[model samples]
Target: MVPIFVIAGIAIGMAAFVLLIQMAVRNGIRMSGLIDWRTQYELERIDDADGGKPTLHELYEIAAKTDSAPDAIERNVRAKALDYIESRNSIHVRNCWIVIGVAVGVCFLAMIITLASSPM
Candidate 1:
């Protein structure tokens, strides 16, 4: 039983570590402003061309209604940005929860192992 708990704890810890790394990389990309460049460029382009400010999603909707080649390209870029933001945010939330859960599991396992081996 003790060995099993030890193994489980190790596995959970490794998983938490991987999640931490992924979160770090995701945040790094976001914080470094790499993800915003394309979105910003697109918004600026739309602002210059139309002079009517629209949110990214709004721009995507507008582009969808248009038949112009430029609008098609804009729609694709906006879609990609929206998708990236959504996915990255979900990953961040999931990583936080998993890491917290793993920490709690490790603590519980430690307590159980200690109680099992200690003199009662």
Candidate 2:
């Protein structure tokens, strides 16, 4: 009976987390594609309704370069700039995912330990 309650609580918590993510997504959409994935804030590029134009590349895609570089990122071709942004953004996104994975793993481990140790 205790295990049943514990499982039900976990389910409810997970459902709440899903709901929170959905709310974040809705809010971001309402606010210029700005999303905070509980780890960091990232801008999501949304193209125009007709698929003719995307949001300005400068809005979301900032070129990553060293401070010592003499070359102006602005001089680079649009494609190259976009590529650099994608790579940089991917690094942030990958870290976010890893953090999420670690969190979930820790939670799972805690749950197992709690259940195993419980006399009920």
The best candidate by lDDT is 1
Q: For residues 4-30, could you state the per-residue lDDT of candidate 2 as single tens digits?
A: 756765765576567556645544453
TM-scores across all candidates?
A: 0.48, 0.38
Residue 31 lDDT, candidate 2, scale 0-100: 41
- State how far residue 74 of model 1 sits from its true place (Å): 1.6
**With candidate 2 superimposed using the best TM-score fit, by how many Å does residue 113's alpha carbon deviate from the native?**
1.5
Positional deviation of residue 24's Cα in model 1 after best superposition, in angstroms = 2.6
Model-by-model lDDT, in order? 0.65, 0.47
Candidate 1 residue lDDT tens string, 1-120 = 666777777777777777777777855665466757466444344534455455666656666666468757676756666664555556666767778777777868776786787677
Candidate 2 weakest lDDT stretch, 10 residues: 38-47
CA-RMSD of model 2: 11.4
Give per-model CA RMSD: 9.8, 11.4
